[model samples]
Target: MARRQRTPRRTDDNLPSAIDRFDDAVDAAWGRVFRGHPVADRIFYLASEVGDFSVLWLLIAATQGLRSDEDADASIRFSLLILGESLLVNQGIKRLVHRPRPTPTEPRPLHVRSPMTSSFPSGHASSAMAAAHLLSKRSPRLRPAIYLLAGIVATSRVHVQVHHASDVIAGAAIGTAYARLADRCVPGALP
Candidate 1:
């Protein structure tokens, strides 16, 4: 028999590793855990709803008048910051990153409405964190509550299968950075 030449297989470093796949795996795992839990679905649905731009605006409108003039001013500025950050994250960074959403292994009811944009840094988490960071600065007494809401919103993103854990983490970091920069740019923006 004639011998045939052997060729080596090429490896593409660009391919995702198990480490890189960890986020998606975690997202899928969370979806599996919350798949049929009615209470969890309801809570996550509500939490995600609070992060919607329109819902956030309503929240601002409802509470703006209840606080002092300075506090109200801070709240308004905080909302503006969130709006700007959302725009930047959704339209700019998301497109650049182009990270696709996690594909669930099985069909399950989503707690929140379907997402339209690419999933990398979550808009909901970004807005939630921005609001929490700025609002907490405006009212130190409400810091814990503000963070709790933000945490809920961020967690809901994962549970609802709209975002990976890393997506929320990136969103939070970006949001906090933006808030800090906004405060630095406008000295009184935080409080």
Candidate 2:
């Protein structure tokens, strides 16, 4: 009997093969299933826009302003917190990671313009999750719906070929942790 030698597995030098495969699989799956539906495209476009501009969070803050002075103050603090988180993720962390955006494997009209920064951590996802976390904590009654929109906004990056699933996951984690910190430091931000 002869012994067989094993060949070395392939890798991307910077990222592990497993992670690369997972990212590729997710990107391919999303492109295959979610790229061409008219209604879904529209929905995701709107969601992406909301995430980009923090439109929903701004609207929530504006509505909170109408209710009472305390609510208004909390909303302003929440907005500032999310803005800081977005800046850190977009400028600091993304430049450090320097991972390129995924190459478009499918033809889908991008709802929002492509981001100029690197794609390791999604700014939109980070901002969305941070806003969702703060807002939901304050308004427990709307938590489920708030998080759902956050999720959709994060996933929309992958759907549109701008980010990998892992990128969004990392962004979500960063956003959640940052929001928790804000909640702790600025008492009453959560409630």
Candidate 3:
């Protein structure tokens, strides 16, 4: 009988190991910084709730679209982008990464909705950042507040112990990239 030929495994494992360590360290640091504060808990919990399915963003869009014709047009366009971003992040990307969430997907004492998606990239973080970007185009005057809200929404995941720090980080980056690309590619996707 002839012996079977063996093939060497591809891709380096050290990089992924190092990344996992970094993510763990950061998540631990985050927990230490803000996990014990009552006020912070309230704020982050509120932000997390608002970030669900990008409801806050949609509300903002509706408000913006209520004014002039131009504002209304821009608002509609951006709102669609926000919804689309959620679908992509929550549905599409979640399937690919398939990373388990920091906590179980079951309802916890926090009373927040437990998401079933994998936790590699946080949909809340992604939608928040993407809406912040697209909505900024609609209302430049509110840019700072918009981005600030986005940051809060993204960090709230970690604060609530629902997602890892690295998941939020990657999600923010992906949201920004997706928004930029969609803004450029979509026909008449103007502010």
Window of ten residues with lowest summed lDDT in model 3: 103-112
- Name the regions of candidate 1 deviating beyond 4 angstroms: 1-19, 57-64
Tens digits of per-residue lDDT for model 2, 96-180? 9988898877566654688888988988788888888888877899899989988999898887778888999999999899888
Itemize residue pairs with steric clashes in candidate 1.
none
Which one wins on lDDT? 3
Better of 2 and 3 by lDDT: 3
Q: Tens digits of per-residue lDDT for model 1 on 1-191?
A: 99997788887776656535878677667777875698988888788877777365338534853678776666677667777888889888998998888665555565457787888898888877777777777668888987888888888887777787888889988888877787788787655
Q: In candidate 2, which residue ranges exceed 4 Å CA deviation?
A: 1-15
RMSD of each: 7.0, 6.0, 4.0
What is each predicted model's overall lDDT from 0 to 1?
A: 0.76, 0.82, 0.83
Model 3 scores a TM of 0.87
Q: By TM-score, how accurate is candidate 2? A: 0.87
The residue pairs found clashing in candidate 2 are none
Residue-level lDDT of model 3, residues 92-126, one tens digit each, is: 88988888777532333355677788988988888
